[model samples]
Target: MHVEPVRSGAQKKEFIYLPRQLYRNSPWVPPLWMEEQNGYGRGKNAVLSDNEYELFIARRAGKAVGRILVYIDRAWNDHFQSSDGLFGALDAEDSEDTFNALIQAARLWLEKRGMNRIVGRFTRWRSSGGF
Candidate 1:
């Protein structure tokens, strides 16, 4: 599996649809498609407009299999005096390799930003629930 940063609408769409596809027959109920799309948009996601963040999609054989979102909240860091990165909205196939690739991609991005610690759920979630 290989990981790539989500840089376009197409990538965002793929990232948004991953969980729905992966959990089609499971009990997970995904948030509305538009809501998922808006959550990734700078115009709609105000937190993103003010924070440093990136979304990564993991793929195997050219198909999206996982995704992870990593962000550094400068305001939160300044208030706490902590060099930490927050990762969330994680979703992946059952494969260990897919999970590893998603995590490594997030780690590399955080490391590049000088983050010393990562804190938060790496589970799949739109709000407080997970897949």
Candidate 2:
């Protein structure tokens, strides 16, 4: 298994759509495709403009199997006076190894940015509370 930062257009698309594949048989209702795409677009998302973020994709046997988005919300840190990092948009296969690899990747990225704590699943609306 390999965990890598999403750096290509193809990887970005995989990151955005992984959930649909992960939850296909479940009761989950996937978000609109355009909405998902727009959320990652710098021009369409105010959060992207204000915060630092990275998207990652996990692959096994050369197949994408998981994804995560790690971010540092400046507003959240300022509002709470904390040096914390956040992660969300996590979609992974039902494998512990895959989940751990994704989380470790996010953690390392956050630590490198000087974050002292890690909080999670800070989805779009939840992250706005800091603002």
The Cα local distance difference test for each model comes to: 0.87, 0.89
As for candidate 2, its clashing pairs are none
**Candidate of highest TM-score:** 2
- On residues 88-131, what C-alpha lDDT tens digit does candidate 2 reach at each position? 88889999999999999999999999998989885345555753
Which is the leading candidate under lDDT?
Answer: 2
Q: Could you tell me every candidate's TM-score relative to the true structure?
A: 0.88, 0.90
Model 2's lDDT to the true fold?
0.89
Which RMSD does model 2 reach against the true structure?
3.0
**Candidate 2 lDDT for residue 5:** 93
